[model samples]
Target chain A: MTETAPRPTLEAVAARAGVSRATVSRVVNGGDGVRGPLVERVRRAVEELGYVPNQAARSLVTKRHDAVAVVVAEPETRVFADPFFALQLRGISKELTAHDSQLVLLLTEGRADHARVGRYLAGGHVDGALVFSLHLDDPLPELVQRAGVPTVFGGRPGWGEGTRSAVYVDSDNRGGARDAVRHLVGLGRRRIAHITGALDQTSAVDRLDGFRDVMVDAAPGLIAEGDFTPAGGERAMGELLERCPDLDAVFAANDLTASGALRVLRAQGRRVPEDVAVIGFDDMLPVAEQTDPPLTTVRQDIEEMGRLMARLLLRGLRGRGGEPGVGGTPSSVVLPTTLVRRASA
Target chain B: MTETAPRPTLEAVAARAGVSRATVSRVVNGGDGVRGPLVERVRRAVEELGYVPNQAARSLVTKRHDAVAVVVAEPETRVFADPFFALQLRGISKELTAHDSQLVLLLTEGRADHARVGRYLAGGHVDGALVFSLHLDDPLPELVQRAGVPTVFGGRPGWGEGTRSAVYVDSDNRGGARDAVRHLVGLGRRRIAHITGALDQTSAVDRLDGFRDVMVDAAPGLIAEGDFTPAGGERAMGELLERCPDLDAVFAANDLTASGALRVLRAQGRRVPEDVAVIGFDDMLPVAEQTDPPLTTVRQDIEEMGRLMARLLLRGLRGRGGEPGVGGTPSSVVLPTTLVRRASA
Candidate 1:
């Protein structure tokens, strides 16, 4: 049992602040109608008393939990090994902390976990949700929509139904890939090969689209499939070499794959920059800088995307979307990515 | 607002299963006394009806929110840069998911946030808490203890008051450090230098103690303090070399620090292993395997430690704590660490 001390109530805070209980309650629940002086007094009294705003009490008034669930649907170990999700989470944490809202993390590994998460979200346990890494066949996006919780996706949802009206924060994967390929083209490299991430994800598919945007009518042998792993990158690079032995430039889906490509190129006695220029996406520092020759890759503001997801969700929750219960269509965000110059490219 | 579809209640589940409401409740809440056949029937009914347990009703019955708050109280950006917290979070999430519980992540940056966290824990919002990376001067431990919430520390709590009876899960840092030093000694390196992590953290302090156990009368100049970052490691390695030019081996506190030391050694024209046999701790794969000569380091089961902490906390919450309200004294767990020998050492 928790220590048996009774917590200070709104009445206590009101008494200390010389204000009405109603005023204290209003201030605690975002101070909608409370005046500035009264709000300041109530806040000071609450702070002095070390009082925590009771979610139960607050829910009784607003019917809101002031909590958001971040659902990450990743069945593959490859995503977990990279720092992409972690960096995004840091941004989300910082933003949510500033908002004084709690973060509930829900990680779904497979079909069963997805169903479980769908049920939890449907149970009205949280005010909103931030769902991430949805594959082409994932049912989570639709499930969340059916649950009717205001949600902001981390990336563009790949599934067809219900996502056309959905809000999401995504980096310009297509444009970033275009920039990378353009940089390689500007370097006087004629035969450029492309190594793609797992095609199931929209991020990878979008990058491939961007690659095709620049490399119009390129030889089919110049493309190889990689699952965004170092080993996968090495294998893909080897296959690309076998098919196009004279290829002078390579663009990988992510830094991990590019690092693997770098190792294979080094082992095959191909000097970076001199013999072959390499560029990757998602400039993950550990992988990019640790490469024999530091990698030049596309940089996405991952943490900022996380922050934006929370900011948008919270704004919707604040009734800024429209009427109190009928949250209007929340705006979606697409952040731009820049090419980070390094020795490899 | 959430979809208006009425959630199936306990009465509905009971009616569907042809059993009493109490029996359905027991099955839903872990099937404590319900028989196998009846439990099966209730589960099927639950599945058929899509019955999601109402947290409000459950709290009224069992006085538990079925939520665990994970408090990470590191003010430094270095901790966020690495993937350490993410791996631990994955382990905790998996365990919590298996147990049908939710995770509320509380990230505290400084003193003000600490107070906010303390009040939240005191407000009885969660059933328990798992706090990590506690500094010696941290007030969170005391606040948690006073709240009377069952907590499982990720590392040993550093405070003196109210923590003697606290439960925790930790890796054997001392033993791991001793093994690293012994391996170097076996390699016929007499003059070895040590780079210590921040002394405020118990992990670093325990590691330093282990180094002292192995090098009883070593020169004071051989030990340099690092803040568990790459830059700190570089500075420490530089200082160690300037002070003791004859040192043949170096044991860094963690892999990030060791990576920095490796760069410094390379820049100073010192051939690794031949001139300076370097070992690191944590064996964080991204840093360890990606280093110039892959690092040989101490391997602590960080994810396992996270899993164990959740397991212990859940076991305590299941009324194994003697009285229903008065949780019994939970035992602490200290997991062993092994040395992963690679080319560096």
Candidate 2:
């Protein structure tokens, strides 16, 4: 192995610059009470010796770590594969990097890992947190809120109520669902069945409610539950077909589920758009664009949502209070969704 | 906003425990000079006050951060969607968490972010680094090596040479590709085509080399470049068909690319397996299993590869020298891959 030289010490730099150790420390920590000549000499010595101050020492002086925790309360491997997770992280990563703040990720294995995250937050390891607690049953929001860290949620946390201090950034899931259903209705499809996502998640419940909002007092047989996977979509589609063979259109909760439904429709000899118009949420390009006939779906800015979460957290950290729509108590931002028309619907 | 009580100070904990400030500090920093009863009293006071030792002060005494940086030099959004990245992260995250360390993710946007990453590493912000520098021209490996933190690479690295100190964890790309081609050969396939991933990456380059090993002196027209994307597969497959209309089989660089090839095959009226056999690398289940005819491909334990990298880095940090296959100098582990047969082949 190639031997690596030990990190250059402050003493080494001081000796090279012909200055005292205190002077070198003063120059490195913003050059307070130091002359310009001494500072320049110290800086040149630092550059020449590749000297970098220990983060621990610098952090002690500043009383802050320029880092934020992105805690994800997801144990399932499925979520990791979802482009939704990846894109959101990218957005957050980009935003944090631009602010010169590091992203310290904390992935929890559901309830079992919640305490660890709680301790980490209370430990002052990071300045703030952006938490993703997707399920209504997830107790993470409460734990995180109790930790007393300035936090912004990724989605409308599943507690199903307005909390004055809970700040969150979410897309208009219910509104998007309404748009998908309305589009199906505009295409003259009345008996439109719905394939919902995992009911545990607020997004799915809201989407189902959106379907109900448009199809008020609709037939009970018109909806089937899905777990937001292709296999789940396939099973729900088969069940829907058995229950209502004459249904004219279908709106799936997300693109992956819609693709699965497409397969079942194709297998059952139903031509998409001709026999059954299909629309999905989250116009996740890879799946939405690659489906058999392509899929007409709702497009939410997933990456933008991530960026907004970081922005909101950073703003809060800067102590900018009472900013409308964000950076204050009761802060919330709901991004709008758009309908992307394709051959499927 | 609900008010958060201030963090309890070390002095407060000492006063609560009815002990000297020095005794409380000693107990908190592992109780070397304190008796068992005094340590127990300090512990109770800490638990009651919910006191967490300041990381900066602790690090000042211990000279360790108990954190590892996972540096990925990928600017594009594509890799995030690739399960390879997510699964690997999950693996590394799990290992680090179990060891009571944190994972600091550094997502680089190519060259512009390289200097920042180097500075972060050299700043002694983390105990070590696990770097993923996929491209050949990536200057990251050199920068990281110069930073001199104990490090491990994700893939075999693109430099294509044996370095005595370069430690990495990579799947057996060449061997996996060999097995894929052998399966085609067993099925009496001739005029086999190869759709290569981005040649800048070592994994893609190795897979391409593997194909050449099986079909020595094969026609140059049989090979086409792909960027390890579904769209790339579609484009490369079309070119291959145009150049050699009678091509009987294809080995795509990865599953996403193979799915694209499958779509093109369906569009071109070529019956899969019957008319044109297809196989892909990296059996990314969501893509591989969802393809029209499903996909026959090589399966690499991506998550396990991630775990191995973390394990090796941790072992090296422990200063456990000369453990074979890992932890010593030239620590590298090439995990084997297997062919998963499905409907496509």
Candidate 3:
């Protein structure tokens, strides 16, 4: 039964408190110029009237919008459906709120949208930018850096071509992939096929390299590629089955892809574990639990990746610059990936 | 082979275009006095110099932040893991970009963070606000409305107690649930147990009501409640199994819960669709395909909901201070849902 209410402004608070507008501003901003008695009065007025300072006004003086943009280079549909991205976004949002900053999300998958995004980011739209899921030779890193804004990448740049070093946080993809493939070999699978993510990304390339390093001595000639999408996994599985029919097991780059491969295998009348063991990366709960026979996969701490990225960007915003030299702890982190065993592989 | 680059500025663009800063501003803003030829010249200069305007200077003139805040009233962990919220965000981000606005995300699940979010939103930090997952009696709607900012809700308010008449875009929860249950009944499923979402949400209440309304005349003593989470579904399912050992079907409030219920049924040696038919709401792609024996569910167009919400909010923002009846239709929109039948049900 609340009535229509007028919003309380700073001027209203100042008038109610019997003080000047400057005095109210000083109190609201916690400046040292305000007297104790006046500050107490202003606080009382703010509480009573529910006066909230306009963010636009504050940004005019501080030049800080108290907002950060999170740009992900993925398809719009994938961005929404991918739990990894969602978890990271949640983590970033939580951390930004603690610092009184807001997180702006931007998806730049379409080539046509790139120009528009560049303009938005360059136009003083946000205080900083956090770019995730970078591919080799992406122009975004260079574009953001040249604009003179503080920017952070969510994962390490695979190409290693940018002049301005990027501050990034990433999982130990190489080690995780190695561990997964080694586990398959240990399970006595003589012929193991690998379903890889998009090769343009370091995540895909690194995982493939790790698998190859393990297969060099144990099993070989069972590698295929996918675009980290379910459909792509299904297509890749079809090709793999056609080429390597005797493959005893498969390792997919992600859980979505693994689910797709499982569907394809089942359609083709293959029994899980007994005939063809399957493993996936990114132990997303829904995908892992619902996959036929469940999926034994690799797990990445996606939430931690988000937290570390936020912390890194905040440090850069505070003028800490990039971490020291090359191989000087890499200015990037590689979190460990654990193997989660289930009925499938 | 890139070199250390300097940040672009209005001065740089002016110098490159052989124009004054005032002329450059006019071109950048598409101000009235600018001629077409000169505007093109200035644009080319901006492109060449990669000039990004200083946000502080822009704020001084426009008094707009060019940003909107998307607040999720859920924990950071769940916000990302939940596909419903994630897809909504994705749709919102796309629409905001089309309107040339930045999207700022906020998570206010923890009680300790609520006050901070209220202050931030109230502080004029964002031009508009989009809130999702409102529980009954939540203070955010009132707080935002009292701030005089345009606010939009993702779902309909159940209790309807707030001062602000929120413009919301909701899925047809009632109809979708009815359709799901009707399908099960069409398959001759009596004693159909109903697993609901959180009862506090209108969606959960409406969906449960839909099931009961259809079942009361057709069948009785076949209702159970779940919290719409997978674990909640599993637990509720276990309880329901004990209560009605002869139940023939179940209608879960969401895909996650249905997936969980499927797992429990499998563990209990129930043959899906043969011994017990099961249906779920929110036809999430992974859950539909990956659940053992697959799942039949209701599909709510998540992306469309997001797009519609963005369009509505944009209309509201444009029609500010005018009559609320300007947007061709009432601010509230309820989109229809479809039944997607698969193997399980």
Instruction: List the TM values for chain B, per candidate.
Output: 0.83, 0.90, 0.84
DockQ of 3: 0.32
Clashing pairs in 3: A55-B123, A55-B124
Per-prediction DockQ: 0.24, 0.30, 0.32
lDDT at residue B144 of model 1 (Cα atoms) = 78
- Candidate 2 overall lDDT versus native: 0.82
lDDT of 3 by residue, B217-300 (tens): 633445667887899889988988998899999999999999999999999999999999999988887767899888899999
TM-score of each: 0.79, 0.81, 0.81
* lDDT by candidate, in order shown: 0.82, 0.82, 0.78
Q: What is the lDDT of residue A104 in candidate 1?
A: 65
Chain B TM, cand. 1: 0.83
Local error of candidate 2 at A250, Å? 6.3
Q: Candidate 1 vs candidate 3: which has greater lDDT?
A: 1
Tens-digit per-residue lDDT, A40-119, candidate 3 = 99999999987777655665555566667788877666776677787778778767877776666655435456555665
Model 3 score (lDDT):
0.78
Error of 2 at B328 (Å): 6.3
TM-score (C-alpha) between model 1 and the true structure:
0.79
Q: Candidate 2 lDDT, tens digit per residue, A1-345? A: 223557688999999999999999988877489999988999999999878776567756754667788887676365475677878888898998898877766654446766666765655557788887467656566556556677888887767332345778999999999999999999999999999999988889999999999999679999999988899999999999999999999999999999999999999999999999999999897889999999999999989998999988888777644446553443689999999999999
